[model samples]
Target: MADMQIDSSPVRTVNVTRYVTPLREGGSLPAIAEADDGFLYVLKFRGAGQGVKALIADLLGGELARALGLKVPEIVFANLDTAFGRTEPDEEIQDLLKASVGQNLALHYLSGSITYDPAVTVIEPKLASQIVWLDCLLTNVDRTARNTNMLVWNKELWLIDHGASLYFHHSWDNWAEQSLRPFVQVKDHVLLPQAAELDEVDAAYRAMLTEEKVRSIVELIPDEWLTASASDAIAADRREVYARFLTARIASSEIFVKEAQHARKSLI
Candidate 1:
């Protein structure tokens, strides 16, 4: 994997000291692990179910989330030494660690945070609107009511587990065109009902997501994670494809904004 520039600096690298436990499997093998820095992190593996692209989405989604002025935990590159897997007794986890030895993604753990439950909690409308707009732009498919993928640690919402966003990259078939496809799933988004100021949120988020910013976030993906091969007809440079997809999506923000607004109307 290649190095990526994050926050105007090369991504800081952490070494995994111990693999504590695996989170319940879904799209990828994420685990709670202790790191050399004496912190616990949720490690998303490249060798897992969704593969490196999921890590790419994780990095891109987190970067773009911060760009939109949303809260996300600090993301770091974790260098997994293959030796650590030898200590693991679980066959499945050991295999995952061996395959993911080189470069993986880690998120600073939130100790006492609980999953956001809309029934028991409510986020402000403006914040909800911003989150809705952000998810729609990335075509995030995992933010529906059942999953939510959000945390409330200290009376504030934080975003997490974005590997399921940017679903277009899973297939490179006319990927640029796919970028322009409307996020029809936004209607079912957990936040759409509370996205009170769609127009205002759209305007602000649209202004914030510049082409330069999109490219910057895309560049944050490690080069090895840029897996579109010469064999793939749609992209030789996966980064540019991601950039085009992002710019196209945001450039057509009005369409999805209206999509969310329409969804909101139906919801209320």
Candidate 2:
């Protein structure tokens, strides 16, 4: 599974050589940092309030989107050094850097991108439905009108900030049953009104996401992120749990698709 490839490319890894400004808008305090590749990336620290769980969500959700032919910034493994942020003056930022001195997750920074504005930008029904379907599949509760978590770059909609997706993992209980349930939060989706093609795109999207593909994405999650949590077997088995949960959720995507369609009807 370690050699598995999505699009024949695995997520690349980079060393965080410089700490840039922090993106304070996020509760997790993700930063825009420079990597050893000489490219800038939006770093999602493993030591934030959401910890490694959020990073896992980011990786899983982003890769799932990419698998479905959506535009997501390139996700990467960011190695943070112990002495990375010693020069920072702020106490809070300093501590965050110190605790996050290990493997973290990051996305290629989309420079000069603007947050998606629903009032101005009009998305085609198919694309809108696809994005809505994706949010439903991930049970993402963050794509509300208040916080779109989307960006308009080069006149295209690119997804970002999926750390808020797969919220079920935060509690880590009854994951199987949770995967079978509907995503009731579909009602709050920003694109629900325009996602009129939900029914049309359902089958095609499901076909695109195979169990092996999902497991490959799950396998991308580092062992440290899985084992860093609990002392119990649940921690050791976390990766398998994620793979099973996603495959189950994809198998039962109709439950959430119907939920999204019904929610869309209400909006119109």
Candidate 3:
């Protein structure tokens, strides 16, 4: 198996100690785990169905968000020893994975403490606008208003779950016109409380991201997740779109604050 070499600067400060508990399962990878150092981390392995590509997407996406200064959990790739091998679905580990679907990845076992109601998410309009900006720049279509995959901890909204994104890479270029569509119009359809602060957020994003870092992050994706030709095409398209989006965002220093303001007034 190829080892994922994360840039030492950004993630070196975080330490992943021991595996504490199993979090969730039933996806391409195994459940997340709690590290003995009192931090939450996910444990993944090379499996029969999914390959390194899935892991690559997760890592690269998370890293990109971190670069853009969004609130994201610190993710590190860990080698799960044989002791953490796959167990039966009825096994405790399998049960943990099953229950973790759709929640924030950081709180795997803490699901009981939180509810999944969209109405309860603490996303303000400004924050929602920034998230939409992230989605557009990454060409991520999975962050719909209904299934806003976010976690609110300590009154802050954190983003998660980029597995379903870059969907165009799965087959053909289905997102050609998506960029030209009216993203501002749909702003009223979601919750965003932080709309007035778009300039501040944009400044932070500009200061943190760079082309070299973006390329490095995307290149880290494994070949398995993009095994087939169709899969490769999807990944390629997504990469191109993302590159263009990032370049434009950086040059313009633009923010979609108006959309968020609309969403707030409409009570989305």
Ten consecutive residues with minimal summed lDDT in candidate 1?
A: 1-10
**Candidate 2 — number of clashing residue pairs?**
0
Per-candidate TM equals 0.92, 0.95, 0.57
**Displacement of the residue 86 alpha carbon in candidate 2, Å:** 0.5
Q: Higher TM-score: candidate 2 or 3? A: 2
Where is model 2 poorest over a 10-residue stretch in terms of lDDT? Answer: 1-10
Q: Candidate 1 at residue 132, lDDT?
A: 91
lDDT of 3 by residue, 10-87 (tens): 432223344454434335445545544454555543341334434444565666876666766556544333333245
Better of 1 and 3 by lDDT: 1
Candidate ranking (lDDT, best to worst): 2, 1, 3
1-268: candidate 2 lDDT, tens digit per residue: 1121235258888999998899989898999999888888899999898899899998999989998999888889999998899999999999999999899999888888999999999999999999999999998889988999999987989999898888878777888999999999899999999998987788998888888888888888888888777756454488888988888988988899988888878889
Q: Which candidate is the best by lDDT?
A: 2
Q: Please give the CA lDDT of all the candidate structures.
A: 0.84, 0.88, 0.49
lDDT over C-alpha atoms for residue 106 of model 1: 91
TM-score of 2: 0.95
Candidate 2, which segments miss by more than 4 Å at Cα?
1-8, 234-236
For each of the candidates, the C-alpha root-mean-square deviation to the true structure, in angstroms, is 3.9, 3.6, 7.4
Between prediction 2 and prediction 3, the one with superior lDDT is 2
